[model samples]
Target: MTVAERKDISNYLNRPYNIIIKSISDESGDYYVARVLEFNGCVATGETREEAYQAIYEVLEGFIEDMLEDGEAIPEPISDDEYSGNLRVRMPKSLHRDLSQAAKLEGVSLNQYLINKLSK
Candidate 1:
């Protein structure tokens, strides 16, 4: 889509909906997934990036219509950093134990070892 078209759509959606788009890869790196996150109470996904974005817009429109019918209040749009914070991911017990052992062998804490590895 052209930049102008995207801006137009964004303006239309700014008042009533919150949308986020993400590009992700499968574990095998053979396929791409486009994920739409936190669209009020609904989430949508598609194989292609553009398809995912379009699906979210269509779904949001329907959701808004239903809310209007039910006389429910629409939520305000969220700011870019509204949900930003420290994030943590879980590791398997075996992997965690291995990492801890490696860190001990290196004479460093697990967090420091991981940080150093990641930084490199």
Candidate 2:
């Protein structure tokens, strides 16, 4: 869920990366997790959402600092806005037929139906 403006990341350091926050609670009391998906294994957790956010931000800052000190390249976030909105996916003919039928039943175009499903 992180993205810097497409090619306009010159001043992105002031605007923090958008991190993903989710509930990781599983009946062992409430808890939350946060992560910078653009950076593999950069994750943090806390008992509350606010704590998780702060923890993840700290981790992100440290991660960046470490990379800079180590002379490693800092990865920029992948922005979806750069996409052309066109993708060619190859699938079985039967599956395509089924999807077309389903889209027809839902009163929506197949492309729209696929977009809706993928967005969720």
Give me the candidate number with maximum lDDT: 2
lDDT by residue (1-120, candidate 2, tens digit) is 134432323343445466899997587877999998777888999999999988987787777766766777777776777699899999999999999999999999999999999999
- Residue 42 displacement (Å), model 2: 1.0
Which regions of candidate 2 deviate over 4 angstroms?
A: 1-13, 105-107
Each prediction's Cα RMSD? 8.3, 6.8
Question: Which lDDT tens digits does candidate 1 get at residues 1-120?
Answer: 467745644564566444566676777553233322434455566677677777766777666566656777656666676776555869899999999999999999998898899889
- Best-fitting candidate, scored by TM-score: 2
TM-score per candidate, in order?
Answer: 0.44, 0.73
Clash number for model 2? 0
Instruction: Kindly state the number of residue pairs that clash in model 1.
Output: 0
Model 2 scores a C-alpha lDDT of 0.79
Each model's total of backbone clashes = 0, 0
